[model samples]
Target: MADFKSIKVTKGIKTLEIDNPTGYHLIGMGAQGAVFKLSEDRCVKIYTSPLQAKMEREALKAGQHLSFFPRLYEYGDNYNVIDYFNAPTLKEYLRNCTYIPESIAMKLLDILGEMKKAKFTMVDAPLRHIFVLENEELKLIDHVNAFKRIHPVPLKLLRDLNMMLLKESFLSRVKKLEPKTYEMWQAYFNENKMDYRNIPVDPGGDGEGVKVDSAISQTLIGAGHQGAVYRVSENKCVKIYPKTQHCEQEKDVLLSHQDLSFIPKVYETGNNYVVMEYLSGPDLNTFLKKQSALPPVVSKLLLKILTSQKQAGFKQIDAPLRHVFVTNNGFKMVDHVYSYSRIQKRPLELFQNLHERGFLDAFLEQVKVLDPATHAEWTKKPIPLTDEEAQLEIINIEGKTDSKRKKGKDQGKDRDKGRDHKKGHNRDRDRSQKREHGGKRDNGDKKNRNRSKEHGRENDRKKRSDRIK
Candidate 1:
């Protein structure tokens, strides 16, 4: 066996990398760490956390004498050396046999019986965790949790076996052979309905549950509405969610759309986080912005993607270009909340923003120039634009209409005020003329009175002169 001191372990996920991996063969891996085959008789388990490694080592020591488990030779802080058995795992057996016989279930119970006698208990024996030798004997691996008290009922094994073997065939076989035992297992499942493997841990935000890709120099890729995304490895990335429920919902969405080419493959899901295949390309919006023009090939690809999405019963075609990546594999949509969630529709701002950013015309031009046939067909039988986009247009039209109405009202008020002012001027002119005319008539009467008086005075004077004569 190689000295574990020489085996380089990367700190991020605590993955084991040999100085020269030429002779070593990778056997398996899990959430904790990995296992590697060193030779015909020797294999080693390496863990990411020292605590986990210590627990595994102690558990192995407690059951070192038990034949049902692997023989541990020596253990370090992060590595364990053990005898590698040349046999097929229970998972492989199921894949080949398609079903587990009743007799095999009985055999497993008998094996569990021996472990119970040794006071080493392991209830979570998924088919994948157990190995079956050519001699039909069994060797259970992953002894980390063996120290827990043995439950009278094998709850973990029952659930895991059912999940690993479709239709719960193994548990069902046990049920038929031992009705009482099956009832106990079924009762246990009902009581503990939660599957820890699928249960999400609250990511809270920063790529929750994300492990460092310590092997790489820089891992931060980008962020979205869900949370920040980080590159964990060459092939994997993690998206942390704002809320725990969002992670669960997103996981369900990803699983439902696994067949779609435009969506990323979801790997591991945490409480508020998801690990998925990392896409290697710039988003369409950024790419188009940088190019300042769209190529004909890009148009054809984008249309084809939208057409495929529509055919897949996904009606929302007005995808935000920023959520779209232009890769050689095809367009990969990293976000799917709008597609599968309750929203069920794309917002109109997606298109409006593209138009506002001056990319809509460029994209349309490419479509018209390159895929004219598709453009014609789409335009003629245009996909029904969502009501969301219409609301934006309505708001714009309403704003302009309100502005025009206000201006018209102001103009009307001004015109009415001008007419009133002209009428008042004519009234003033008439009043002045009337007053002048009255004054002129009074003066003429006065002159006439004076003339009459003078005539009277002349007559009086004539009378007085006559009287004097």
Candidate 2:
């Protein structure tokens, strides 16, 4: 890399800051650090933390025997010099390829065998870390967690391969070449309800509420693995439970959080359904997918939600990111499937999961920017902020968010009016058809009466003429 002396790095929870003075092109990034392409043969792996850098250094030492892994030339406290070997990762490779060749499948299986022979664990061979070169070679990298790990098979690679862009096509080839391996994969993909066919689950009907489908007036907005959630009215939605007593458990979780606005208020409940406030907004998962970084207001809202749950006598706050939503009112947590019933608390479970996934460090970097002093102190012992305190911190970001929601509401209102107008137009059309049909019936009756009179007149004339003769 040219002008490398000027590059500086700062790490965040999910991302990193690279002050690259040399203008090196960025090839990839993760929780560990960013990689910048220096030239065709070399690149640098910048570490987010000293520990990760040390781990990678050690990984390089252990993996020296493996020709496919990146060769470590030199290392600093925060970065490492290694072979660039610019090639698409297997994940990228599979995504771009129109079809998977039988040869590639054979190569992958052979690689697994080689990994075992080399005493390398399956953890070292993630499809994303493995690269495919033009010379029919697979370059496997990233052995931070691969050392001495034990697994009968490459489970992560199997799952990653399962989530391939062209899943069916990839599987078809695997089934043809490796039948037993494909069978193992099929069973794993099915979870508890194993299906050999690997057909997609139909995204319709409440499993238990199918019998009561006729009574449902609203459209089914979401159907999950467990149950179907429907938007019934303007402010209310219903979750129809499975055949089991699942609704009881979910309802209990909701009833426990009646006091919190962050949770949807339970309006009514039935034996197999839960009628709750319909929160209209994108879920956290969807929002995060489109974002470059987590907004400060969102971070604050997350803290408050966790704190409130803890204060409300709930032991678990390990809510999935998908269950949380960003609404006009603010953030609200939904799907309390993992709360109240369990006594064991998962207070920092969300953060811990993020950290393990390499997002926590990048997110914390943002927190540091928002409040450096607090960030410095929280590093030693993390603490949640009060509602008032969080509100004060993100006041500016909150205002911007509110403005965006106002714009969205205006658009929503226009859409609703258009739908109403369409309904009214259909009703008017029906009324016009009824009036036209009624006029046709009346005209037919009048014509029939005139014909009867003419027939009577003709009969009378015939009788008079016959009498005269």
Candidate 3:
């Protein structure tokens, strides 16, 4: 008997490392643990954690009745001895083949049905975990979460198909053969505002260059603080920047990554402009606003872009929502000015933008389902509040402007009241002065009348005296 206790397993940042001192032949290794072939028909799987080993053992014991699952012979604290078959993984098969056949799709669906029959809550498995046997049959491994987690759909399986460019064909088969399941999946996608039928299989643009003249007039497609984009041809657009350095930076990034499917193909470069493939679609911000939901497809595409950028050795993996375009082919990102100069491990700006748009929670949920490791790593750190702060700063500026406007209005009202009060006071004073003047004139007239009457009486008396004399 081989001593499984002699084997040592250490947990790393993202995966487990194993130190095997025994004569067991190493078959495979993953984040959970390592597998070693014990015999011609059996293998032993050792887990880094006993809890995970226990979970898989129980799940395998429960699923032993199904032909798709391996037969378990024995299980210990952190290891399981199960029947093993030398077969290629579905991922490897797909890599060699151009497209998935209908028979394979049907078999996959049947496996899911069998899992459902077995009462496994999580019917999902990655392509790499499924082994393709000789008779077009499937065998699934890594049953740790089969009974523990509850997922309504095979999200991870569908994600794998999407990544392999085989989802459309598989869904077509589902739509014809398993209409009910297809409807359920479609409803789920619809709820998330995702159009799974039109998932991008290839990157947009042909490897062709476009010609442009600086003096020629072109239709202005977009304008921003950095530059202006104008449509020079039906399939090409020219982005002209005010600064040559900015143009040089963007052009260099684009030229270096021309083979990438999601990147826009570069045609020509000038002192301050670069002609590239014209991307025809709404920006990510506009799409989210229009749909009012963050679709799982968008989250997957964003994660894929980040992974590709990392693989291509880009330092800055973040992009604003406005810079990401949702085209018919796939998601395309523009503005690579910071991709080389800035060092960022995660897409903090993108997450902040999602947070500001009220889609952060939904995006994170999708991430948690599609890529748990990424979700763990991203949630482990704090997402910076730069976008939030920018939004708040805008609100504050508008608030201050409103307050100033209101204050100016109030001050104008106060000045108007003062002017009215002064006018009323002056009018009253003029009325009083007029009244006094009129009273004096009336008194003077009265006195003159009396004097005239007295003079007349004296004249009459003098006349009478003269007559008498």
- Over 36-71, each residue of candidate 1 has an lDDT whose tens digit, in order, gives 666678777777778888887887787777777788
TM-score to true structure, per model:
0.47, 0.41, 0.45
Please name the candidate that would achieve the greatest TM-score relative to the true structure.
1
Candidate 2 per-residue lDDT over residues 301-407, each given as its tens digit: 77677657877877455444556677778877766643654442333434533443435556567656765754555455332222221122111212332124443
Q: Rank the candidates by lDDT, best first.
A: 3, 2, 1
Q: Model 1: number of clashes?
A: 2
Clashing pairs in 3: none
Task: Give Cα distance to truth, residue 216, candidate 2, Å.
Answer: 36
Candidate 1: regions farther than 4 A off: 1-4, 13-23, 96-98, 148-156, 164-167, 176-180, 193-201, 208-305, 308-335, 338-469
Q: In candidate 2, which residue ranges exceed 4 Å CA deviation?
A: 1-6, 96-99, 148-151, 165-469
Q: Decide which is better by lDDT, 1 or 2.
A: 2
What global local distance difference test value does model 1 have?
0.54
Reference-based TM-score, model 2 = 0.41
Q: RMSD in angstroms, candidate 2?
A: 29.5
lDDT of each: 0.54, 0.55, 0.64
Rank by TM-score, highest first.
1, 3, 2
